[model samples]
Target: MQLLALQPQRLSAVVRAPASVRLVTPASGMSTYRFNKHVISHHFCANCGCAPFGFGVGPKGEETAAVNVRCLENVDLNAWPRIPYDGRSV
Candidate 1:
């Protein structure tokens, strides 16, 4: 997977998988890290070491998960619009 700095407002596509979905070899499962005021847990593959998505509470106190569009297969990233975001300063 390609490593890039994530910024605010950057478009990302993700799919919500069933909780029953299990991680296998080559996947090496995932690890969580806290960020953005320590309210969110970022999940990444242990083997590939790629962050596929993140989970956390929203402003309304609801659970949410965000997945990386680049992580999905059969998707053409070049066809998407590259928007600028500045999340680091937040």
Candidate 2:
């Protein structure tokens, strides 16, 4: 999964959701898993076993979604600046 860090406000502005945003699950069904004392909820496609995104609480205790940018359409990934993160350390 390609991770692009986007602020919640920016994401909401881009998506234009005034209230809340909902993610559409795959037709076959979606399975969820949580690690590290259930801090983050990882969502996966049950049929293909591919992860689409994750739901977690932000640093400020706000709900956040970590979307896999690879799932986005009609976008040039190369154009975006890449910020490397050491997930293992976290």
Candidate 3:
């Protein structure tokens, strides 16, 4: 899945009812794994094997979330500038 990076501040502005967002594992069973020193918690839906989002700490130590924009409805992905992030080097 392609991941779009957004700051928590910006994300809150875009997502309505941000407080209602929750990560739920599917009843069919799903897996949560971490890579690169286990910095982020990657959540995926087992039934469809789709990763809708992930949670991790930002560079400044603030909590951050990376949401898969493709999963969002009515969002024009092309409207946003794509910024390349080299998380592997972090």
Give the lDDT of residue 12 in candidate 3: 15
Evaluated at residue 76, the lDDT of candidate 2 is 62
Consecutive 10-residue window with the lowest summed lDDT within model 2:
9-18
Cα lDDT tens digits for candidate 2, 1-90:
243444321221122122354566552467898887686777777778766667777666777666665566775656665555545666
Give the clash total for candidate 3: 0
Candidates 1 and 2, the one with greater TM-score = 2
The lDDT for every candidate, in the order shown, is 0.59, 0.56, 0.56
Q: Highest TM-score: give the candidate number.
A: 2
Off by over 4 Å in 2: 1-22, 26-28
Question: How much is the lDDT of residue 22 in candidate 2?
Answer: 58
Candidate 1 per-residue lDDT, tens place, 1-90, comes to: 222336433436443433523344333356778865897777876677777777677667776666677667896766665544356555
Model 1, C-alpha of 66: deviation from truth (Å): 1.2
lDDT of 3 at 29: 58
Of 2 and 3, the candidate ahead on TM-score is: 2
How many pairs of residues in model 2 come into backbone collision? 0
Q: List the residue pairs that clash in candidate 1.
A: none
